[model samples]
Target: MIFKRKSSATTWQEVLEGCLRRDTKAQRQLYERYANFAKNTCLRYAQNEVEAEEMASDGFLKVFDKIEKYDSTQPFEGWLKRIMINTAIDHYRRNSHKISWSDLDEASQVPYSDSYYKDEHLVNITADEIMMFVQRLPASYRAVFSLSVVEGYNHNEIAEMLGISESASRSNLSKAKAKLQSWISAYVIQQDEITHKHE
Candidate 1:
């Protein structure tokens, strides 16, 4: 009976510990559990699902390759998130970011809704569509927008994370917001037109 319980314990926490040892099977399991989340993270930084998925795969590979460097003392998910963030940065650096930033404030916080209705715009727009739009943004805007809006990082953290000045971080976020608002405005107009036509 004790042996059976011990066996189950080994099967559980042992798996995560295996990741620290760079065991492929354990890493594969971790990847499976977190791949979707990481992919979504990547999507915010990529131009499309295909590219996001590819970046996700690369991030996972990096995690596996650098597992030994991961500190067992820290939360595994946080460590993994850092890897995903780096992967996104790598993608950004490979592309472009022509915009510059200066002193700017974050847009006012929107209250969170405890419940969501299926009829909401979220149903109308796929997460991929939004991600593609974000990816199309210039590199400078992309990181700040994704970090502030999606990942919930503040300007200071964003600046620290990307090694930019605080004002630069704010500026990027501001420009990103203005651009996204324009895109949303256009999308809303298009939807209204379609609805009117259908009616």
Candidate 2:
């Protein structure tokens, strides 16, 4: 004889409980519900789709492995997001040494040029273009930028998470912004030249 769930409504709480019990269906459901969100978090820290997907998969495995330890009172999605971000950071730490580090003092002192790329120019750029520019950043800069700008984490929090000094976090973020500004300025100029040539 097969037993039926008393109610057809399978809330997220039920899904979490089921996942804790190692139910395959519940696990699949949970992954399906949050996969995009997890992948996007991975993408922000990843250089490409393959890396992002790998991080996302690893994050899900961690989520399943540690789901039982999750606090029921907290937001499940937020908890899951933190796991994904940590997974991405782990990937960064593993490969970070391969990349040369920038001078921390130079990065810290990289001045922002207000007239370089206006706010309106940035507003006009497509999200995909912005993401592409971010992906082009050096790995160290990318990690700090994603942590500081995308994830909205403060420098202290980012430093703790990435095992770097707070000053390093600030420096990396500053350099990333400078690089992105340069790219955006160049792109705007190129587009304008093309528009004028065609006119």
Top lDDT model: 2
TM-scores, all models, native as reference: 0.70, 0.85
Write one digit per residue (lDDT tens) for candidate 2, span 76-129: 889999999999988877876785556678885787664655567786678878
RMSD of 1: 6.2
lDDT of 1: 0.73
- C-alpha RMSD for every candidate: 6.2, 3.8
Which ranges of candidate 1 are over 4 A from the true structure? 1-12, 66-75, 90-126
lDDT of 1 by residue, 83-184 (tens): 998888877656535434445444323222213213354467766566667887876888888888778888788888777888878777766766765675
Q: Rate the local accuracy (lDDT) of all candidates.
A: 0.73, 0.87
